[model samples]
Target chain A: MPAIDLSTTPLRELNQSLHALAEGNNETEWEVLNPDGRHAVAVGIDAPVSVDIRGPVGYYCGGMNKQATVTVHGSAGPGVAENMMSGKVVIKGDVSQYAGATGRGGMLVVEGNAASRCGISMKGIDIVVKGSIGHMSAFMAQTGNLVVLGDAGDALGDSIYEARLFVRGNVQSLGADCVEKEMRDEHLELLEDLLQRSGITGVKPSEFRRYGSARKLYNFNIDNADAY
Target chain B: MCGIVGLFLKNEALEPQLGALTSAMLATMCERGPDSAGFAVYGQSLDGEAKITLQSSSPEIDFPALAKALENEIAGAVKLTQRATHAVLTCRRDELDTIRAAVRRLAPSVRVMGVGEAIEIYKEVGYPTAVSERFELKGMKGTHAIGHTRMATESAVTTLGAHPFSTGPDQCLVHNGSLSNHNNLRRSLAHDGIQLETQNDSEVAAAYLTWRMKQGLDLGQALEKSLDDLDGFFTFVVGTKNGFGVLRDPIACKPAVLAETDDYVAFGSEYRALVGLPGIDTAKVWEPEPATVYFWER
Candidate 1:
């Protein structure tokens, strides 16, 4: 394991140094110490390497990530793992707004709370939040699975296109065209697997509920006009 | 700080380009602030008025009184209506200075940043694009402009407290970082009879530059004085009728990236915002020096 000290170095220099150290066919697990809320730190990593960021990030951390398992020891700013294609991003602390936003693929696990608009416009990401999420979470979500262990705020999943919402706690309200779905055996099994993958094993899978779009607003329907 | 972007073509050729450019800049700096967004478009003449559009805090002061005072004291014919905090007014181009002066007098507690004849300011409590869309910013037009997206750390979060703050006639400023000597400088400027509008630390810097410019100092000299007098980590860009100026604190705590070519010049809180612009001279990209003043003439 290699260590990159970013105390006094600029973020671009730190990224260059880390990338330089990771280059040359060196697939080493690197530890970034004293991150100190830098923006775009450890972004666009493609190598099959693992990185552990020490503290909270400023913005766009781990953006467009591919094939890199990045873990943050602290909270994240907006657009964490944004547009991610592959790999895993694990946040040990609460995350700021727009976590996994517009991500196409990969898994994002938030151990603590997440701010508003989490997974907004997400294409194909899997987000598992152990705590609550703010209002307008998953707005305009095209395709994704958002698992929230705690309560959600107002207008959850408003204007969603196609996304699966699984919540263990109370939901404040459903967004436009979103309705509660029956949690059956298949969903329970899938939730169990996701929770276990996120390292949350204590809760029973049957405790959670499922919510998704009723397809009422997929096309313009004069009969269901009032639902909109 | 705030983001300012406006385009004033002699014949309305580059409205789309300017709006796209401003939107790109704001989107790139979205993380710089996710608070409020507002903007103005200058060419729309409704009822033979200049059709100045503005966004601000809701349930504001009376526009009639503001317009009447501006008409009497500032020498402008002002007609203003409030939709929430945003006020769209129309006045003669010559009366812009008087309107600005009267606004300062009327809204002493309001941060009057971003004052220009064709000025556009977009600020809210979120990313710049979202705020811009909420305010329907795509149709704004002029020859040139300025905008701001604010991150609330030192000041309270309100539409009245957003950026692209106006200092004087045809002058607007967008600030990125803090000004440590705001209180002391505010008192000194107040002693010089410059009434302040907001509690924001950056407002003092904007007002200081405006007062200096009002005293016949050029933008470069006023910015230089601010670099010398104002304390703390600040990187700001000021726009005027002539052009725009960029300044940074000696400590260099804030960050600004500049990209300029023969056709256009752009600046952002980050470089990615300007990455995919038209006619981008990627090689000429550079960050301005700390405590240095850089301005572009119209």
Candidate 2:
């Protein structure tokens, strides 16, 4: 394992060294020390490496990540793991606004609560939050799975599109075009796999209530104009 | 894109380090708002005594005889302390009105920064770190302090346009976003006998809160009322004589993080600003919710 202390070294140097990693390189495991709430740590990585950050990080911690497993031991600021293509990012503590925003392909696991706008505009991302989520989560989402273990705040999945939302706890209110939907065996099996992969046990898949887009705002029309 | 930081020390043991901690917190947000910066420190209040912070372009010329001029009219021995381009005049609480009138006549260019028994305001049109150094912020001791760095989207980058706007005695406000209805609010506030000093939207926000508080509203009630009356996206960090408060607008696009330990309560626009605080690793840190009032009082 190669260890880098960010307090004494420039963040650009660390990022540059990581970006320079080749496919066949032996330096596969990396440890980042003293992140100290710095912005854009471990961003834009394309290699299949494992990075363990030791402390809390500021905005956009694993942005645009691909083929990497980046784990933050502490909380994260806004836009964490934003716009990821392919990767696995895990936050051990709470996260601020818009965690995993606009991600195209990835799996994001948050062990703590998430603030507002979680997974906004997501595309094909699998997000699992062990704790509650704030308002307006999964807004305008397309092709994703959001699993929340605790109570969700107001306006969950507002103006959503083609996303499967599974909430085990209470949802304060649904958004304009979001409504409760039936959870078939396929959804139960998918949620089971997601829960098992995320190391979540003891919670049955049947406990969750599913929500999705009402599909009324898919096209512009005069009758359903208010929903649009 | 302004940055705001506030610290309220619950542990009196950390009271002496309030200025250093707040200055460091503001320094981390320099990139967010580089146009100008300002701060207000709420320190201990002396019985029957109050002070007013004044600023001028030429402190060397205006601050020299200000003490004697105020003492002659106010019938008390005025204490003056000058730092960079700003000065503080301390005297009997009831005689401040006379001193204000005398300072206007004696030093025509001096502008009052803030007036309170326990608050002193300092501001300059420069980077936050450099302005903090000019104000000797690291040397001051206080129970609580709030600071602001302005990006100047809605107003020009002048000393008055800088934040920590003090519209009420022992109360100051620092903002992180622009107000949309400040012009109309300014007109109505003027109709209600509240005069604002600048076209800056943040000053209007401060004056509005002060006006609401004057209408028999507490700080928390005034903030809750503001959610309905004020039109804007704002994350405000407010400082009162014995309290520190934070409020985010309904949409809450402007970010704000708050941390509370056994020793202190701290507010920062970003998590980076709070990383340097003591015991922050174990502190209960979280983002302030939208349209919520979080207040800590002594």
Name the candidate that leads on lDDT. Answer: 2
lDDT digits (tens) for residues B119-181 of candidate 2 = 999999999999999998998898999988889898888999898899989889988888999
Per-candidate TM-score against the hidden true structure: 0.52, 0.97
> Number of clashes in model 1?
46
Give the number of the best model, judged by DockQ.
2
DockQ of 2: 0.82
The 10-residue segment with the lowest total lDDT in model 2 chain A:
A219-228
DockQ of each: 0.02, 0.82
lDDT of 1 by residue, B51-162 (tens): 3445434455666666676677754457775444456666876666566566666766443434445554545566678777766555555555556677777788866567
lDDT of 2 at A144: 85
Error of 2 at A4 (Å): 0.9
Candidate 1 C-alpha error for residue A159, in Å? 55
Off by over 4 Å in 2: A222-228
What is each candidate's fraction of native interface contacts (fnat)?
0.00, 0.76
